[model samples]
Target: MAITKDTFKHVDYLWDDEKAKALGDDQVALLLYRSNILGADLRITNYGGGNTSCKTIEKDPLTKEDTEIMWIKGSGGDIGTLKRSGLAGLYMDKLLALKNVYRGLEFEDEMVALFNHCIYDLDSKAPSIDTPLHAVLPFKHIDHLHPDAAIAIAAAKDGEKITNELFEGQIAWVPWQRPGFDLALQLDKALKANPGIRGIMLGGHGLFTWGDTAYECYINSLEVIDKASQYLEDNYGKDRPVFGGQKVASLPEDERREQASIIAPHLRGLASSYNRMVGHFSDDERVLEFINSNDLEKLAPLGTSCPDHFLRTKIRPLVLEIAPDTDLSDMTEVKAYLEKEFEDYRQYYTKYYEDHKRDNSPGIRDSNPVVILWPGVGMFSYAKNKQTARVASEFYTNAINVMKGAEAVSSYVSLPLQEAFDIEYWLLEEAKLQRMPKEQPLSRKVAFVTGGAGGIGKAIADKLAQEGACVFITDINKDNLDTALATYGKDTGSGALMDVTKMEDIEKALKAACLKFGGVDIIVNCAGLAISKPIAQTTEKDWDILQSVLVKGQFAVSKVAVAILRAQDKGGDIVNIASKNALVSGPNNVGYGTAKAAQVHMSRLLAAELGPDKIRVNVVNPDAVIEGSKIWEGEWAKGRAKAYGITVEELPAFYAKRTIMNEIISVDDIANGVFAFVGGHLSKSTGNILNVDGGVAAAFVR
Candidate 1:
């Protein structure tokens, strides 16, 4: 990849022209300050990874006098090469009003008011989403970036030591924070906490510093990143690891359009929901090679460049390991892969936020990574425009390299899941959310559940039915379906009897469900049999029955169900009931556990295969669910009781006490886990294992 001259030369122009541009006069100096600071801001980090702004008094045509407004960059303009037209004006008074007043305002509302009140013209590009930070900063010029070198050192084990030695006491350190409003608020609090600070090192992020002049701000970024880069060159790996591989070309135009068509719907949903345009493309060869890599596990670390970048990049990019023997031109397969990938991203966000936030305000800025990597194709970054995409690419490239270096020294530790969530969804983070618009991608959705008689299946069925969805509750046992109808039947809800393992039965049942509800929005495969026995003692008959119940049952139902869901045009959601044993091997009960494990993989494969149709598949791994079901009282449960050397009555207690917190795992808890996934709240989630196990058998108790 060739580095363009515009990338470096344009930024350095300020060094020569600064003195010529402004000799004095405060307003002219401020403009010069902004121009110089912004030039360095762009080069300090990657393209769109940094921002610079100047707050000054300008005459308001409507007010007919001098009024304060913030001249911030638009969403996609690169800070380093930012032109005069790139700046979006924001009302300084409106921002000042929101500075200390924190309640009764939503994320999008604040953003809208800030943008609308301050912008010079409505036709111009909206103010940068980082407007809040500028609003809060007291400096005449502000510069911030995810500097590659600085973060590399700051993320290390000896980061504090190195950071202390590098700048002495000039820099104040901020722990990693999800960007947006919460980050702005945190910086505000930090300033209050420490009276005088010229620079801030955001752990795991990059660097933030401001000065009275643009030159100072620009110098600060270069000096800091250069210092850290030199330190890394000296202390890190002396021998550079070779990235030997074939350089792949960009996707052809037709292929690009095909890719766009497949992902456009979901992209639109994301854009509408977040109120941020989601312009994206997969053009990079390295990203494509990475996505198309043979190893799935290795792809986990290729997330966003920084925590805040997740808003654009998502948690991780999709891996496109297209098999040689497979149909390469199948756009359906491509679509399936993308949808499935998005679903899991949503699940991760939900689980991350669940146990972390103690307060229930808009807690982390929801940052989902937007990059996609195709095995044979190149990697792609998503942004509102070309500039933002370039920024994402640059930051991600540097971050990935640093991560490689860190891995060589010692493993890079991720923030605790809950703590990560706290930053991602904090009240202060809600500012970004407010800027978004309302979206209903799965609107007019209707769903049906098989084996909606008891336990996990019934819980999922009931929740969807309550969420304005027309639901069909089915069971092989007529009595159970009858009972379900009696309990839940309402305007659009109904019930029926069908054996999901039987194809004819599933076909007939789905026909009835569609006829009654007009179409299906989702499918929940909740039907399966449980018979636990050791592999050594297991008979061929037992294995057959178990596989028949778990795998065949799901296959039979989904085959016809997918057709109906596709016709509806609205995307569908699928939830499968899996056990904790599926994740960790089950003890002794090889027959049941093995079959269940296969069921999990089956869901995953289905997710990968069915995603293009906008149908998502996910598995719910519940541990020790013992409510509203005969499984708890069946002979199988009694046998397990004997194996554990406890009576059937004491078994629940045994499982409950096994967790670190000694919290009992209930049916409702499992239900809630399923509910979060099935709800539009997790629209981008699928092909994931959600453990609703209440801290089950953790190696260490916190």
Candidate 2:
């Protein structure tokens, strides 16, 4: 669709005259409206990729005098979700004076300090790097963005000529220059020379449009973008390739999951620095088409489609030579192949950086690849956190689309290497990168919680997430799993239906976790069952049910998880939720007690076997944790209460008073003990049992 004055009319403008008056600041309201409009359309601007500003009058904090202020989108804030706080207010007079100070400023750091000092409100967020351009542009409102359509024209070889023709005399052109005081001055000079120009297109970068009001500025941006879109449609519509191509057969879902389960951990190990990296897979049709293309080798490595993307994804992605049918089971071979590829990529990137390094160039970033294109399989994005991985995935996906569009229209070209280095090293961009909160202790760590729908398992998953771990929770009951996921938030915790009694279901869940969060670093075997009855009354079916869920199920899940953890070669934790019944069986609890006993023994044995591989296995034996515990609700609570000679309502107090400490064991209490084991709080202790029984003498193993 061609952008017109009414192109975005369908979008809900959150701010109208009534709301603007209610807000008491029409400029800020209009700025919010314009930012949301631009941000709403990915074709106009993607996440964290655009800035908007307005000139208004506000009372100065220091002088208490009305002064002209420039309110612009703050650093690191997404425009679509921009709030009043997201826009920093600066004294226009003080900001415009930075042009004089720019004459002496040699370092970007000094300019940043100067910009920070110009804030009209000290409590406001830092202003955008393009503050100078916005301040000098003379318009009451301004919008700057890296719209895909505009980028297609800007990054082309004949971009200047095409842009001139498309906009006629309505727009001016700025040659490629790193955004700074100098670029701002150049833009001001160009606009002054051409008094009638409505916008400016920066070669190899983005577009800028402005007007007297927010609506006019927004409409001008749309109109410019629409022209570019129309040009591409007219010229390249026939040449653009269809979405589907050679019907490359895909592996069965089961087989693909198995393969991803194995390969993801290996990739995680190869990409890890001091901390393990997480992986995110994309089977997006665009990604698949790019990877499966005959020209992938030629097209994939030719730098990012836009310079702004360099900050998130670097210049290019690394393409691994693995296919869907490749054997990822041989960890040693896979590791070696990946290490070699990484080394080669490092050498090539280092040489490229050195060749293009300028006096002001940012130094080289880590050699690790952010986006990895695996032939025959979908692409993967790696990062120290899931959010970063998702961001890289998005930018790379956009880069692929832009390149494909450019190739279809004409030849695909990118900004010069030197320009990319400028952006990568640009102090403003670098500061934005550094401003992200420090990685938490378990920032990139992934944890899997079986039986996580409720009870102690749910608590354990919540604790893991609190410590910065991405948690994948599973339960046989899909409804319970859904509820737990909703409470924890789908972003922080994902869920899958898993019946521990079924080995195939166990494998499928493990693979799903691996594919979802790259790999698992910690596994909590919390799935269990209880069948309380006298040995004579307990049928064979009851014994099998308890044994299959508590004993055999734990064994199956642990075995598969340990294989992945070993491939990761990273030290991992396994915390099995045993029970106090294992140490001291209650009356008629033969099956449940025996199953819990087997779990404790299995944990100890696995600890011994996996110790050499740095995998720690430990057990948290919780007793009478009746509060918020699904295990102790309904019939189980009634049965246990009957055994204790008390009503169901009094069962918790009865169990609490039975212990010497007279403390009620809670799910959080058990979760805390498990945390001590999994968080490496007891790093040196393994094959050990932690008791959360509130001083139950009968449960004391030592």
Q: Could you say which candidate leads in TM-score?
A: 2
Colliding residue pairs in candidate 2: none
What are the models' TM-scores? 0.44, 0.92
Candidate 1 weakest lDDT stretch, 10 residues: 2-11
Model 2 misplaced stretches (Cα beyond 4 Å): 1-25, 237-262, 327-335, 352-365, 427-434
List model 2 lDDT by residue over 140-185, tens digit each.
9999888777777777777787778888867788888777777888
**Residue-level lDDT tens digits of model 1 in 1-702:** 432323342133235445635655554345535554444643356655567776677788788788887777676566655666777776677776765555532453354444556566455556665788777878877777766566665565556566767777667777775556667777777777766777777776777788777656655656666666666556544543212223334456456444433343343343223333323344444344333333224534534335645544555554444432334334476556655665666566566556565755464444444554444434445444333554555555555545543443333444445555554564444654575555333234556787788766777766765554556878878777777788764444677788776787786677655434334657777787777667787889989888887888888888877765554445678888878777666556888888778888999999999888778899887777776655665877776777688888887788888876677787678767777787767888778778887676642112
Q: What TM-score quantifies how close candidate 2 is to the native fold?
A: 0.92
CA displacement after TM-score superposition, residue 689 of candidate 1 (Å): 51
Give model 2's clash tally: 0
